[model samples]
Target chain A: MANSVTAAKATRGINKTIIYIVCIGLAVLSILPFWIMFVNATRSTAEIQSGLSLLPSTHLKTNWDVLTSKSFDPLKGFLNSFIISASSTALSVYFSALTAYGLVVYNWKWRQAFFTFILCVMLIPTQASAIGFYKFMYQLHLNNSFLPLILPAIAAPAMVFFMRQYLLSTLSLEIVEASRIDGSGEFATFNRIILPLMTPALATQAIFAFVASWNNLFMPLILLTDKSKYTLPIMVSLLRGDIYKTEFGSIYMGLALTALPLFVIYFLLSRYIIAGVALGGVKE
Target chain B: MRRKGTINYAKYGYIFSIPFVLVFLVFALYPTLYTAFIGFTDMKGVIPKPVHILDNPFQNFKELIFDNASFRQSLSNTFILWITNFIPQIALALLLTAWFTNQRLNIKGQGMFKVLLYMPNIITASTIAVLFSTLFAFPMGPVNSLFDALGWSDAPIQFLQQKNTARGIVSFIQFWMWYGNTMIILIAGVMGINPALFEAAAIDGASGFQTFFRVTLPSLRTIMLFTLITSMVGGLQMFDIPQLFITPAGGPDNATLTTSVFIYGQAFKGAYMYNKAAAASMIMFVIAAALAALMFYLMRDRSEGQLRKKLRAQKKAAKAAARGM
Candidate 1:
């Protein structure tokens, strides 16, 4: 028995070491592409063409010059993307919460049906409706405008569904009743009491909403034809197509610049983001 | 004196729901119906004209199903890419989740590992595609240089210029980007299983593999179904990377052209066949809806269903006794 126990212990130790090695290897695999992109961003075109290096060089300023000298301006792209993502995220989170509250608080006949409708709406992919949406926007001359992009976010069905699930678990109808007894209006109660109660859900959903909007390339690619109004993804795509194709260092720099904001955001709020994904997964 | 009664707050529901309802009607519902409607019409070109309903409403559908080689190829490509990536992705995710959530092998620094692993997912697909393209650039790129240094090949391989290599890279990118997400989700699922079941398994002398297969896997039915359905739906809509990765959008004989890319090309590129694009969208919608329906069927509450059946049988017996009385 003693010999068997020691054998098992030794096997377990070996297994643990193997698991750690695999885990570390995967971690490196995950970050290697980003590291390579950043390192290549700092290297000259010739250097990049010659070979890959794990170390950074001093050609970043030169690459930046090449990037800006072209039609694709990273700063302007950042501003455009920020404007679109911020507006959409704010609208989506607030409106979704409001809709969830509306569904939950009031004892209405159509409440269940409306909630079911929203659930169904959540399954409908955006790409399914793109053709008609594009045509309709074009007909209304809403193309090349951010209105089509930002305003439609007010009806984010998936976010509403998530918020509804959140409210179902956390919200107490007693609070709404208490506020009503205290002479508070329904909307006022929602704004003050309910919104505050939903801060955690709001923040989590807001991060997801912001990231999704920031990374959105399909709708914007089709809708916004004007270069001045181009978002970062579109700008990065253009860099691939134009004469900047041969400028390898600048191309890498542009790619890095596009991904940098997301990296910064992820590093800052990674705990929340990972937690949010886990939470979202659990509800299903 | 007012009678004690509950206030009628039914109208408040409608009042509060007005914005969501209105926006849903205009933006979401309307656009979907419009797509369906235009699918039956003969609309094309950049100019917006009066869309006349085709004599055969299924003309575009019939043509696409029967005649359109590119659409068929794209549909197959979409499935191939999704299946190739999804199989490996789920395998790796399940393996990692098992390890991460293992009770005996409590891994340290899981948080840092998770953050790093999930980093690739947050980056824009367009940018990732471009980065990969440059990394594997023809003749004198990072990948080629590495191969040369290692003496792997006599000549540099044109990674993107070839059909299979292009498809493989796209599939690999999809796999790399999504495995972390799948792992996180599965970890949540594993974490949610009742500790009692695990304890029961342990007490019964169940090995770790046996416990996972019996106790953990069975308990994760709902969450597993959720992940599968969502991934399926998302996979069907794969577009950004394939479109932006190569020039001429779905190049090298269109080996990487997906259903969404096909629809996009029809609507926006070349002749601007909006009707055809709408038709393809409707087809994809049907496919997605079918998958969702399958999920719902699989995820239906079996206990509730059995309870309802028992209640109905009990009610029948009660009715029979009352008739006898």
Candidate 2:
């Protein structure tokens, strides 16, 4: 019996060691490209061309100079992306939560139908609507404006679905009942009372919506015409285009700068993000 | 059971959902319907022009699917990239899921590894594309230099300039970016499985691999289906990485051009044919819908099987009763 127990323990040790090695190896592979990107951002064009390394260099300022001197305009791109994504996220999160709450709390006639409609809409790929959307925006004289980027957030079916799932799991109608008893307006109850209760869900959706909108390339690429109005992704694409010389150091700097904000945001709210994914997976 | 002074809450539902309803009408539904209509018409440029329903309503589709080699190439490239990435991606995700959820393993730093792994997914595709293009840049790039130093080749190869290499790199990047997300979802799936089942498997003297195949995978069927369908849909719409990696024309002889990129080019690029783009978009929609339906059918619950068996038994009993009568 003792020998059998010892063998079991030996197998456990082997399994644990194997798991550790795999986990650590994958973690390294995951972060290697980001490390290379940051490292290359500090090197000169020639140095970057020379070879790859695990060390940093002293030419970050030179890269910054080259990046700013080029027509890429990283600062403007950052500002444009920030404005578009922030407004879009705010619109999507608040409105989606409201919609989810509305569907959950009220015993309206069309509630189930509306929910099913949103689910069906979720299945229709947005790429199918690109042609008419482009033409419609042009006719509306909204081309080159941020309205096209910001306004569509109101119809984010995925966020609506997720928020609805979150609400169904966590929210209690008794609070809405109590708030109504206190003579509070419906919108006021939603804004003042229910919104505070939904902080975790809202934050999760906010991060996701922000990242999605910030990384959006297709819509903005078609809508915006002015270089001054370009988002970070659009500008980065242009930099990588073959029309320009697009210096290696400058491109890396542009990429690093663009990704840094995402990394910071992700690291800050990673727990919520991870939990959100779990929530989504389990509910689905 | 009527309350004393509760106000009617049903009205507020309409009020709260007004923004969403309006947005959907103006943006989502209308555009889709309009695109379908425009697919049948020959409208070019940005303006509203006269579109006659000429002899061939299906002309745009026929020209696109049959005559347009670029469209066909894009379709094939998309499938090739998605399948290549998906095979290894699902494998790695399954391995990671199995390892992370193994109770006996008791792996350390699982949270840190998860955070690091999922980091690539959160970064913008454009940024990743730019970073990778530089890494694979001609002659002077790090990959080529490393290959030369390792004596794999004396001369530096322009990785992006070769068709097969470009497609392979793009596929690899897609795999690298998505495998983490897939692993997390699978871990959630494994976690959802009953602990009693694992204990039962252990008591039966089943090995880890045996337990995984016999118990874990069967329980995870629904979640696996969910992941597969989602990944398939996302893969079909892949645009940003391929768009930025290759030139607008899907360069190296249009090897990396996805359908979405092709549609974008047709709509917005030099010639600007909105009609053709709409037709292509409609084709993509059909393909995506058909694929999703097939996956759903394939992964449907076995209640149908039970229903069929029940019906067969009922029919046999009825026949036996008739014969006895």
Estimate the overall C-alpha local distance difference test score of candidate 2.
Answer: 0.86
Model 2 chain B, poorest ten-residue lDDT window?
B1-10
Write candidate 1's Cα lDDT for B1-325 as tens digits: 2325767787888888888889888887888999999999999998778889999999999999999999999999999999999999989998998899888989999999889888789899999998898888898988898999999988999999999999999999999999999899999998888789999999999998998888888888788789889999999999999998888788879899999999999999899999999999999999998987787677766754785598579769978987787
Question: What TM-score do all the candidates reach, one by one?
Answer: 0.95, 0.92
Which docking category, incorrect, acceptable, medium or high, applies to candidate 1? medium
Show model 1 residue runs off by greater than 4 Å: B1-6, B302-325
lDDT of 2 by residue, A1-284 (tens): 99999999998888787777877888898888889889888988888877878799999998888888767788899999999999999999999999998888886878878986786567667798988898889889998999988998998888888888888778888897788778888899999998999998899889889999999999999999988999999988877765445478777888899999999999998888887777676654
Q: Candidate 2: lDDT of B53?
A: 62
- Show the colliding residue pairs in model 2: none
Computed on alpha carbons, the lDDT of every model, listed in order, comes to 0.90, 0.86
Cα error of candidate 2 at position B64, Å: 1.4
Docking class for model 2 is medium
- List ranges where model 2 is wrong by over 4 Å: A1-18, A242-246, B1-7, B46-49, B292-325
For model 2, how does the per-residue alpha-carbon lDDT over B181-240 read when each residue is reduced to its tens digit? 888888988988889999999999998899999999999888888878778888889999
All candidates: CA RMSD (Å): 4.0, 6.5
